[model samples]
Target: MLEIEQFLHWQRAIGRSQNTVRSYARHLSQFYRWLAARGIVWDELDFRQLCDFVAVLTAGLPPLPSRCGGRAPGTVKAVSAAVREFYEFHRVEGRGPQDLVLTRNPSKLPRRAHSFLAHLEHRRPREVSRLARPDRQSAETVQVIDFETDFAKLLAAASTTRDRLLLSAQYDLGLRVGQALGLRHGDLNPMRRQVMIRRRDDNANGALSKQKTQFIVEAPRRFFDLYAAYLLGEIAHVDSDYVFVNLSRPPVGGPMTYSNAYQLIERIGAAAGIDDLNPHMLRHTHATALAKAGWTAAEIAARLGQSHSASADVYIHLASDDLAEKLRTTEHLVWREPQQYRLKGDGDGAR
Candidate 1:
């Protein structure tokens, strides 16, 4: 527990954005509980045992002495990665003269080892993880709402301009909940109609950017309209520098926290008669909307402020009729517009 606490503090000191530090703290806490329940020493785990931990997570089993189900593969992988970092950090710090044996480097392994390649159908290097569930977030796809219907309902149901702006940030700008809440007034560029997502560790609400570096995202014209209205109307009296803050609620000038966003969105969802609506679902809707509008996978990733196209791939779902027509025309289904291909392999210039 002391080591975990130290690791979290060091993460913040080293300029890890607030969201990442929170994730490391949150997941490490869960891992600590699991280790306690199983009576397993975390620092003493061998590489194979660490992989087994990931395998157990992949299978959706609860930790010992608990009934809660497992997290998704991406989340589990994140936790695993954090644990590896924790061990490595302490090892390098010479705590217990510890050493990380996971050895993520592939160069250390023998090249073309026949015995190791025997059952390797996918050619995945080592047993570092079998938890690479590609569609791990596929459940989010079902939660997405169409742009014309449910998204409108949500916006219409919002009781205040502040809440409406929050929804717009997620839907129109494709911001994660943390990213939206972390926004400061300085990040908005009305002249350019862009919002800068700068990586930072400071926020009164403990909000943080998930992005490692700064990037700007284009915002809808209507979003800025609402932003102006919110500033003059609902949020005018708030004393916070954050773009979004508590307006009518208590502690009225405070930056919006994750819990505040969650509860507010849930209330808005109920008012709209939309069940289980969440902030992330709005982001999901944004990505899917772009896909429907012929945005390529890379374009979607850029719009979402994600670095990997694979992260954007899950949202490229097509209807049966569309798939059938595309398959009929060509042997493969193409999601990008033809011109988007010429933009690929060039930098993130498309962004």
Candidate 2:
């Protein structure tokens, strides 16, 4: 019999998230139960058996709605990771046969070009997706001005300045919701007019850094003043508390929920006559705007916490001056001027 409890203990000790640990536990339990039904023990498992297990999971089953809804990519990946980790853990412990192996690939389903966007449209509780179909031969084009105008309206119409600030931070500063919510009173240096986003302390619960690296975001004078005044209110609590919180008399901390933050954006969009504006779209706008403003792709990627690799090229392409710079930087030989250091008017070099 496999000692599942011992493995779970080790996982918790390793500082995995509560949700992650719970998910791993659930997946391993299901796997163990399935193996039990077949009268097979973990020690006796092999790669072939593991492959069969994945095949069974991939087999077309009756479509039933789950809490996560029908078969999500994230859920599938998590389950697969749990199973692989379990076997790998046993192998490392020297208790199970080394023959046991699980494929790391989660989506055995056939690749579909727009499946993810479709899933987002259909499965997501609140959001709607609309992907445009363009001619393959014609160059793909996006109306950046439209995106900016719509997003700016959304930010302006926010019910509270805090909500406006949140949107502004996402669009202007390129911060994730977690990072935004994680901001603290002390993080803002009004004297210097710069916000330091080092380690986030969201609430009494506390939050850990998602990227592990601390960065600073420069705010405009008006934004800094709004933040300063917001801090001065009786609603503001301790110096370590989150900057944005419920506007209660006592000032309940721990930051707002992710859903509330999203709903705030959506609500603002509705008010601003913009149908859809998401947090991620704001992030995209931030990156695209920076690129358009002649900022290097590397700089955008660093600020956006993105990988400095191939996709960086997209930012480069998005840059406004790329074409102009390329043309200007090309060098051409005006004249040969050879033949023993010839004078300004040589036969070969004369205009």
Candidate 3:
């Protein structure tokens, strides 16, 4: 317990966020409990015992009768990773034996590295997960919400106009939830038909754009129409600079928090009968739409504010149907923005 506390403290000192620290602490705690029950020494844990622990996690059987649910595959992987880190930390501090051995795979060399830090990252031996099984997923198997069916249902199920805008904000422009929540009144440019994504650190609701620089998002005409309707119906008298604010809640004019946004998405998904949907799915759907429309990797990266074009390959490489092509045939958008403005085309792409 004390070792975990020290590790968490060091993690915080090294500038890890509170959420990340909590996750590491929880993961390490669960691992320690497992070790204690088996009368296993923390540092003396061998590979075979580690594998058995992972097997127990994979079984999703509750270790204690009071516990109700089983751990997901992702959770199993996370817990094992924490255990490995815990032992490594203790060993490095001269408190335990060098039990967690990391061997070079040589196969995972820089030959296949493509992204900015990919080569530098693979310069050393990668952490081969001996505990959890490999999560084998193909590049062509990307799951995204269908705009015409699932996404449309999600929009119609939303109770308020603001909620519809929130869904559209993510799907239409691939705006991150934080960026959508961080939106201010000044960010919306009705004349230019753009939304400025500014990176701010001082939002009262703690919402922030993930990017370091401000970028303009070209929004559809329907997006702006919804915004106008929302402003008139909900926050007509409310005095807040934030575009999306609490209309029915106690904080009458305050900006919507991340918790509020997440719950809204969950509720909308359930109402639309969408299985296990999350907010990021909308962003993925948007990127997949672009990729299906034959947008280049550089173009998708710029649109999504990703660090590199190689990162967009996953969306482009998917073996999807002609959904984007079909959607584009019906959709219409004008090229309009203040600084990022371009000459008008035939009005086919998302503005």
Candidate 4:
């Protein structure tokens, strides 16, 4: 445990956010506990032991009291990363074996194309190498919901002004759920119509941004109206600094948790007849709308607080489908049937 403390201290010393340090600690603690239960010493950890640990995690064995179900691919990948980092730390400190290895393969195109144009393009194909470490599975394509239309329905279905504002922040300003929940009253500048997303280690209810940098996003005047109404009406007596809070009986005046936000969205979505509504989906919907409106990749990235334009590629890809549809629709407009020619009937006696 002292070693684990040392590792966490090292992480913080290097400027890792508190949320990140906590995640690393949780993942490492789980791994160490599993090792202790199996009588596996740290010095004995190797490739085979790592594989077994992954299998146990993937299978969710021994049935932990919390989250006893099988882990998702993303969860498995995160756990793998934490374990690898822990081993690497010990190995660097000369306190553990240095032979541990983790394999990862690069993303590549598949051999068979799903479309004729893809086959004709002759994209380079790649196969998994037996010697390489297994790569994480690709994430599912971003779902493109009609933000302007669906968001209206969501807002209409919301039971309170707070829920309506929460939905609006994510869709209008492209905020992650954590960012939206982390907002404070002072973070808003109504005169400028902008809100700041700050990075703080003490926000127990909110996760820090991936980039860990403070940035501002435009919040329209209408959002300010809803925000003001929520501030002075629903949560007027609450003393919390968090912008969003629970209005229910059990946890009134408490900061809203991710689960709380998810359940609220789920209920509202069911009421609105929308499916799989999530905060990130709203972000994606916002990005797609921006891309369709002729925003450059860099501009979209800046608005979304992404570090680079590369992350905007998914939105570009989504817009490509729209472009294809437009091309199909305009085909007749750009193309015309050639005029047919008729021979003159009065040409004297033919040649």
State every prediction's TM-score relative to the real structure.
Answer: 0.69, 0.54, 0.71, 0.69
Candidate 4 yields a Cα-based lDDT of 0.78
Say which prediction, candidate 2 or candidate 3, comes out ahead on TM-score.
Answer: 3
Candidate 4 error regions (>4 Å): 29-33, 59-71, 103-158, 200-213, 239-241, 246-278, 314-323, 329-351
Each candidate: how many clashes? 0, 1, 1, 1
Q: After superposition, how far is residue 167 of candidate 1 from its true place, in Å?
A: 1.1
lDDT for each of the candidates?
A: 0.77, 0.62, 0.76, 0.78
Using TM-score as the measure, name the better of candidate 3 and candidate 4. 3
User: Against the true structure, whose lDDT is highest?
Assistant: 4
Report the poorest 10 consecutive residues by lDDT, candidate 2.
126-135
Candidate 3 lDDT, 1-351, residue by residue in tens: 687788888876775544356668877776777788889987688878877777777675445222335655556667777777777777789876675563335466335436787756646555665553444532223358766688789888999999999998998888988899989999999899999999787788877776778888899888899899988888889899998899788788899987788888989998999865777778888888887777889999989887799977665534424756655665555433447656677466766
Which has the greatest TM-score?
Answer: 3
User: What C-alpha lDDT does candidate 3 achieve relative to the native structure?
Assistant: 0.76
Tell me the tens digit of each residue's lDDT in model 2 across 1-351: 337877787787886644356668878876776687667777888767765555444442322124333443434445666887776677788867776544323244334477656855754232111111122222432223244677667757876667767876777777766677777777878888777766443244333445557877777676776675566653455444677676642435546655567777777877887655556557667777777676777787777666564555443335456566645655334344455876666677645
| lDDT of each residue in 146-210, candidate 4, tens digit only | 76788888899999999999988988888887788788888999889999998776776755665
